[model samples]
Target: MKILLIILFFVNASTVNAKTFSVTNLANSATSEDCLDYCVDGVCFWLVCGWGCSVKTTPHINHNLPDFVVSSYNEPGENSFSEVQSLDVMKNIQGGNLTTNSKSKRANSGLKFKEASVTGNPVAYAMGQAKYLCNSKIKPYMPYYLSTLDEKMWRSGLSDMLYLSTWVPGMNEVSSNKNQTDEFLKSWGSLYPRSGFLNQKNEVKTASVIAARALEVVSDGGARIYQSSGCTSADCMKKNGKWQMISPVEENSCRAFGIESVEELKDKVDEDGQYGWTAWRNYGCCIPGPGAFIGSSITGCLN
Candidate 1:
């Protein structure tokens, strides 16, 4: 696929404050993070410079291009947040793009979820049908082409998770990819702090969204089990299990992923074994319904 990647780098010069050096590309390589060097005493030492900004090589920052929002989408972008007065009503599809249950329900679940997103047997056929003609916006990446036909199908199926979660305001529960890309922007428009991409809300949403879709797409919901990197995975396993938590022992990484209550779920266990403790809110994806527990638990943890 023609995926866009923005790159950034830093160069060394005389270290007087505000001394502007051109910071020209010293090495002739497409990979910006490779070493191009001198040394402490003009001898060659090894420097590894990539997104992590290791010493010895110049720092390189990378960003994805053809940002999703710019593409033509079925849903309308947020227009009147203040005048709408109700987020619930704002998302209503009576005249437009929602269901009555869409307000209370986290998302379409069970077999209905299949039709709620996209449909088809051939992968390319479905992706091509992604309804740019419904509203019709213009972008280079609209019909994003990839090498494998399966990849095209995967992208098509994943479009539901990516498009809906991103385009819809309710789904964008935290600082999104747009915000992430901005915070990371260099002079050439690469994000400054590479770490910003890791704990990013968009990253979590997209990753989880893609994961959810990937599960469904690859296995047609037969492979219900998914392995996630953060809170979502932890919470999924937490629900429906005996769940002997180790307790919040100053979990720094949990907080970093927007997990506000790592400490609370620590001691929390189902004495009655009926109510599974917060599997949704504690998980990576924000289940933005009236109750926070919408996305996490499944069927009351009996098993």
Candidate 2:
């Protein structure tokens, strides 16, 4: 009896202390083929007119850097990444009890609510080390946004309702489910409210929906632009940033929201109701020339 009790105690403790995502694992997730989409897009010239023009090749690099690690889970203090577990303490004090009740309600109804946290990826610098690849704008382990702290905006859903896209169909949708013949283009959920509540049925889909919303919030506001020549528009989805699945199932590929289908991701659901993703932004760089800025030409490179 004594031996059995000791074994059970160790097993339970291991389960409680287990971490699904960590710096080491996430750093290993980086793959050369998917993360580094390096290509020479165009050429820049510094024309001296009388003197011969100095031409420099400009490369349009697609770096799948782990800008942020977004975690969406049922438990308030339970984060998949071991580093940001400390942030959960604030979550518990704020509205952890409310989240507990919401979890039970989610199981009963199709409506689901998940608390999400966005933190700087610990392995961002390591992943984005290519010569001309874009530098990460966010620092490792920096807590950008915590859903529990933004109760009025994230929980109430009032601010998001004001947007016309929220009411009108096909406005700011994450993806279109209508005529998506491609399996990787299926819709997961809406992008409005930028909140925790979602009407998704699948557990994996719910976690992804929350993660997407959190990414939209942070990219649009917190870490605006990582690339030097990237778009400066309010919509981060437009040629500014992309997402790479990092946890539960890590993918070497990186793509825009609608490009990657949620249907393919259904099977990779984490049993603990935890999910993670890395935000990848585009960057355009050119080798320096000894002359002033003049003009550049494009080679039809698709960013």
Candidate 3:
């Protein structure tokens, strides 16, 4: 009893002393990418756990067309940060309601309905998504990335972005909206298994490569945005000279991305050999790239 009590006390003490890091976006002074870069590179992870982040897009959204260029900023003034401490606002942002609702859209003029750029770096894209969650106070357990497919023929998004998972929930209710989420997961394979990206040749795999390939196909093919319903091979991207579109992963596939195998994941799964969502939240990283928010001169901590 004494030993267990001592261990518990030490654990609690460490948690209490854990440092809280924050990323700031100054109004008219920081680019969207700058905000995301801070979140991804700085605050998103402490060792392995993710500290949530978000962005205030109110300053960047404009009545004109979306901005696609990435730029820099100097510094921001006192009252410049667009604070979003409310969970409701965060949900609205994730659900696409903030930018779609007419009244809200007008009130928040800087917002324009669009996706992140498909041409940029996949790692950067992933970082941007992490920044949004980190700023919004969402804790990230598994690392995730975002990519855009910008094919000329596809005007609207076919799919917003592809999310890779580290763990797969097995026959357990992991979300409040389990029905819909499961349906999507059921159709699209629950566990991503792989943790890194795949190279252009797919021989050299890493997290960035995985994101790059997935984003390229989804953005270019426009294959049913954010839907788990099956998509045809027509949505696949051109690999080398041929098209590469993988079918939805099998349910509870529990595969790992990089060198790690399904067996390794099996070893890590809970005692029941099943996994469920624990610290996950309903989050998204999609359209509204920094270009969509950039104005003239910008300033903020891209540190």
Best by TM-score: 2
Candidate that would win on lDDT: 2
lDDT of each: 0.20, 0.60, 0.22
* Residue-level lDDT tens digits of model 3 in 74-135: 11110010111111121212211223232332323332222221112122222323322321
Model 3 has an lDDT value of 0.22
lDDT of 2: 0.60
What are the per-residue Cα lDDT tens digits for candidate 1 across 205-246? Answer: 222222223222222221122222222322322211111111
For model 1 the TM-score comes to 0.17
Indicate whether candidate 1 or candidate 2 has the larger lDDT.
2
Question: Sorted on TM-score, highest at the top, how do the candidates line up?
Answer: 2, 3, 1
Clashing pairs for model 2 are 184-261
Stretches of model 2 off by over 4 angstroms after superposition: 1-18, 46-64, 91-108, 126-130, 176-186, 221-235, 238-241, 255-263, 289-295
Per-candidate clashes come to: 10, 1, 36
Ten contiguous residues with the weakest lDDT in model 1: 64-73
